[model samples]
Target: MLGVSFLPLKELFLKNFILVRDAHIEFSPGFNVLTGETGAGKSMLISALLFLGGADVDWEVFSGQRDEAVVEALFVRKGEVLRVKRTINPEKRRTRAEINGSYATKSALRERIMPLFEIHGQHENELLLDPSTHLSFFDRATGLSELQREVESLFERKVELESELRKRRKDMERLRQIRMLKEYQLEELRRAELREGEVVELEEAIERLSHVEALKEGINRVLDLLYRDDHSAYNKAYVACRILEDLGRFDRTLRPIIESLRGYGAAIEDSWRELVAYEERLEYDPEELENMRARLSFLRELEKKYG
Candidate 1:
């Protein structure tokens, strides 16, 4: 199994400034303290330690001095050394950091250093006086990490299940639409009495009926050409017969021409009789057209209802 390690501060230095020439200290795993006279630089040492762990510092306090500060730490986990260093230049009021003698970011150094140290100053006494903060510390001390991990795991599972449920809901909606369409189609088919091949039959019937007026006009024109008042087929054939008979003595072929005219006259007479019979059958009943319109309207209504 693998284990994580934490870095720890080991030594700090403040040279030629702030009522101290040089100071060095080694820290242990347990609690440590600094006690000295007033203006002994004890709080300064603590501030320097805080600054090394990415805490903000007031450069104005060390103004007009050669403000050189260095902090070094030996990080031990299971008795192994991981070193960190930080240096500050008072002239520029800027800080620099290194990890294991390699240059590093202040944020990265803070991440490595914060887990190993907890600082409590006079302000912490006020926090201890607050019941909420005290209760929070109690809760945190009492194995809250396990509860937090469980909550996080459950939250992740809930998110995944919610996504799956949304997909299922979408699928169910599609099925419902399909079912509705089928139901409407079934209802329309039942109400309209539409047979399997009824659409083709009705279309053909409608096409024939829609052209009723044009058909009637064409039939009337044929009837007039065959048996009208003056320019009729019968009158034309009769005139042709008379002409052919007058020329029969001049040419023998005129007899056959007269016979052909007689045959055409008979054919025109039969066609006129048929046209009168068909005209009687070509009557348009509006009720049948209204029934077809109603059937088509019913189909369109069903499409709108379920489409």
Candidate 2:
């Protein structure tokens, strides 16, 4: 009892526990012990306390046809009453706990409730033999428990910061990869010498080159019809003008008709000259066409790859 005037755990209550349907125990000041027959529910009382201390137990502890088992403890310190309750539902296969009648977790029970009292079994001396618990005992003796708790908190914070740093490093690596890829793409586009509307211009050029021979043949036919052949429009217009001019000399009413025929002949001559120049300008270079085709193919590949 650590020199306390009253027991820290004042009372323990159990319900629907194995071999003990309902039992209540009250403790007096100083050390206490329970001694009874082999099946007189003494160990069951200890089990109830262990359950209140957040120890895990199986459904068999619920006894008979009970739906749930409950273990509760009351403590008195500095004239304050603190109550802890633990409940296990066999059907649910889970434990529910409370502190001072409010909801609590098993971790809360272990950290806050279990520290209020100590339970010693037949092998209790093993705790003294183990070296791991020596620091806890020393801290308690020297009143350094608060300092240890602070150090533990700081250590936990350090661990959290380290984990966050690792995550940030991974994110930075991912962003670096993305930035490198974008830079590579920019370099490729720079090398490509892309221009606005370039694809449309290339496609039009390819179409023209594909039909260059057909276009030249068509222009030749047009020239023959307009002026190249002996029965062409220019020759006919010239002959018609002469006939009209001779008629106009005989009759003044034919003068307007002769002038109109001369104008027609002039228009035909201009059209024939323009057609001949256009046909001569049409050059079909296979090597130039192949180069354009290669450039266009490369552009299409770039488009597909990037997309």
Candidate 3:
């Protein structure tokens, strides 16, 4: 039979574990022995202790209809109460652990918690003979286990700090490279000597050059119909004003119509003069248009590159 002993076990609770449905066991202080025939669940208690100590188990055999098993143990260590719980869930394919109501990893349970129990199976002597376990026994005997635990904690902290320092250094190096690349790109854009709104201005200039003939033609048509044609609007208004002036001699109310026609004739002549001046200013330089197109293309390329 396997034997287990250690610090005082205050309580052990098991549920859906092997043949045991639900068991709540309390132990007293001092020596205790578990005696039972084969298949009487004596070894099951030993298995529960091992599993609670972070030892892996085949959950299929322990699980109930719900495919879950749980083991919780309360122990008094150095006059302090310690509680540990282990749960098996085959459906999730994972084992969960808790210590004093807080979640803990199985490794943490083995390193910090499992030392509370001393298991003595039939082959326990084999493990006792292993050289790796001797240091732990020596530390306990010399009362230096606490000191060793402090040293281990410091070492773990040092390793974590080193890892964080290395990551920061890597990130800084990447940022340095990125800054250098952006500086080079900025210099390239500066060399181009680009101006704000220059692309829009160039596009407008190009459009004016492209349709110079159409614009000139439309303006000339307006000017001719308004002033240059024999029967132009200006000439018609002048003739109408002269006829109304003669009619005013016959009726005093016709004088108002005559005055309005004269104002209309003068407005038409003013519009024709402004249009002629605008038509004279139209530019048709292909070289200037091509240069504007090229400048616009360059600016667009820069936008595409920088963006």
Candidate 4:
């Protein structure tokens, strides 16, 4: 059998005033009794013990006297010294605990105190009448060990399954959001039908059209120099040829001039042919320009829709 022992309360109070001051009690391995007259602090001592166990206490017990109240207990259990301290303020009232004089918490104290001590008050008789609390009371009264083990095992399994269920629910919610975003992105990409290298092709076409005016002006200047009215290169070339032909019989230097005139005449003729071809290419096609404009407009609309 497991053994338990409790040391006496070192100090206790209802408020600033002390109730049980520096009191000590030692219990053996059997029954014990705490008996006193009514209103003689027997019930008060029990209440203090109850407070040490994780029970709530009413603030009215210390109403107008003082704001702070304290109760402290010492225990010697299994060769280890345990200290319990409870403080009550107007705003908060609970137990503070220590093991081997090291600071602990009320929950820690309760864990050690539960098996060592069990308080059965007069109100405990009411459990005999209540069917709900009856079975547990009988189990405790008879020390039914195996049933307690089964209940504890089932309780632990239930907690573990509940924790897993909560985690799965959170994972499912995260996956659902990810799937929705991917589906929307896929739909947008499908509707656009974006083709490879389409952007590069469109950019090249736009660059060519952007320099259209400059290209046309250059071509016109060349054409004018070759074939236009009075200052044309072709007219100048014809005049040079006539002068060289007249001087060719009179001077030897005029033979070189005649040869130069023939070369200039041949170059001008070739330039004239190239100029006609350039003029034909510069002629605008209305249908093709309209198609380019429509395609750019459609691309802009799609970009806006997706964006």
Candidate 5:
């Protein structure tokens, strides 16, 4: 027969566990047997006790209906109470063990509290194999020696959010570098001082000025042909008009021809005057042309360098 100290559990408190969200229960002095139907949380309570005794609990065993699950127990041995608490945190993928309201390790919890109970099941050895067995159940008839062992495997998962946060911090630095590079490029562009339509206007000015000598010669030739030459078109037309006037005095039908010839002479003189005015407007400044060429070359260099 087992003595009173063989069953050392005094009280247990569970919060946010699988089915029992919150529960408080007290055990008798000796040989406490939990009685309930098969699926009535009897096995879950045992698992909770094992978890309190510093045995590793697979994170998947919790229902995940809550963020955290807590299992605490009070054990009595020789008129002394051993209070142990275990907190499971799913988010951080970590487990914490406490003893008597102070933080403790799994080893300390096992060395102190595991000797209080005997656990035996077909798959139960899996949980006990880590440190040692502490809690086991017996039927009402204690003669049956059948044991079922359940081995629970557990692995601490890497918290992906923390990893992602670290990666995001690195990415932030990269983004900052890219932004600074763009700022430097913008500063270069500003220093260059580009104008919107200046390139096209300067190109056109260069095109007109490049052909200045040829245009001047052409305009002088036209002025000579119209007014300065000995047989200029304007003088020839005037002479023709005088002859027509004399001929029209003899023939009345020739009066209209005389009037038309005089009008033609007037139009030629107007064109001659306009040609002289146009010739005076032609200019070729070497310095201005050189400056324009230099400006165009500078713009081309800038395009090759930066664009």
Candidate 6:
């Protein structure tokens, strides 16, 4: 029937609420009463005020389309505006509140805004139903509201401490998980012995080892073609030069030809000797090759495990 405030409650605004899509109610400077017929939303307005004061919400209070229900109130305190707003999200099955446009927890809303307005309804929240809290109502009747607030403040402080304890427990649990992960990572790297540039070096070595047999065979073929038999390039070149020189006695015309190809035969002989020297210097040690193969195999194992 009437709402009271410690400071002036200037206005209340509601939208998409039950039985009324939108409405704005302005309070005057003194005692006031809301006069409306039955089923005219007088009770709805009271329910909205109670909701803003942190009462249990009934989403059935939602109107058409059933999106969201908003209840906002403006209060004057020390020449500053204290705005309290509550929104009901039926889709999410949750309710949220704000004080001065900043998010406020449910307990914070209960502590901060629940006392701004008092309602005497026909609901079960009466002194007869719960006589344990009768002392608070009696204190108000006797103008002991300040003392009642002190008691409530102490209760709120207890609630805050309990909330902080719960948060710290969560933090401790999170730290435990982080420690386990770091230990696991340390063990893996210790086992892997991962090092800088190791992957690149291993890759290059593996490439070489994979093609090593082919490399040896190719070099052997080059040596054989140079001087492995008398029919080889160097041997044949020298034989032609000598036969032409032998024919020079039968005909002097062959003499010029012999002289011309003599230098060519010598060039081939010199090139073949260089090839023999290179073949002698080549390192074709099987033990070293086997060692390289084992290293490549070890590197492959490492790649599979770490990667």
Evaluate residue 182 in candidate 3 and report its C-alpha lDDT on the 0 to 100 scale: 93
lDDT of each: 0.69, 0.78, 0.82, 0.64, 0.74, 0.73
Q: Which candidate is the best by TM-score?
A: 3
Give candidate 3's TM-score. Answer: 0.70
Write the residue-wise lDDT of candidate 1 on 86-193 in tens digits.
776788888788877888787766655543455455456433564534544565689675575578679879999999999999999999999998898788668866
Candidate 1: deviation at residue 99, Å?
27
lDDT of 2 by residue, 1-307 (tens): 1212122778888887766678888888657777878888776776677677677776664534445777888888678788989887777677899998889988877666555445445656434564645667788889898798789889879999999999999999999999999999999989999988888999998898889899999988888888889999888988888888878878999888888888888888888888888878778889989999999999999999887
User: Which consecutive 10 residues in model 3 have the weakest lDDT in total?
Assistant: 1-10
Candidate 5 regions with alpha-carbon error over 4 angstroms = 1-7, 122-307
Best by lDDT: 3
Give the runs in model 4 whose Cα sits over 4 Å from its true position.
1-53, 57-133, 142-145, 200-307
* Ordering by TM-score: 3, 6, 2, 4, 1, 5
**Candidate 2 stretches greater than 4 Å from native:** 1-119, 122-132, 246-268, 304-307
Worst 10 residues of 2 by lDDT: 1-10
Tens digit of lDDT per residue, candidate 3, span 190-275?
89898888888888888888999999999999998999999999999998888888888889998878888888988998898899
Deviation of model 4 at 154, angstroms: 1.5
Task: Tell me which of candidates 1 and 6 scores higher on TM-score.
Answer: 6
If ranked by lDDT, best first, what sequence of candidates would result?
A: 3, 2, 5, 6, 1, 4
Give lDDT: candidate 1, residue 125.
45
Residue 127, model 5: lDDT of 34
Give one digit per residue, the lDDT tens place, for model 4 in 1-307.
Answer: 1123233333333434235534445454454556668777676666666676555667666555444566666665356456666666644544354455667666655554444444454456432454544555567679874687588779879999999999999999999999998899788778767787776677666655666677788888887888675778888988888987887778887888788878887898798888778766764556666676677777777678766
Cα-based TM-score, every candidate: 0.43, 0.58, 0.70, 0.44, 0.38, 0.60
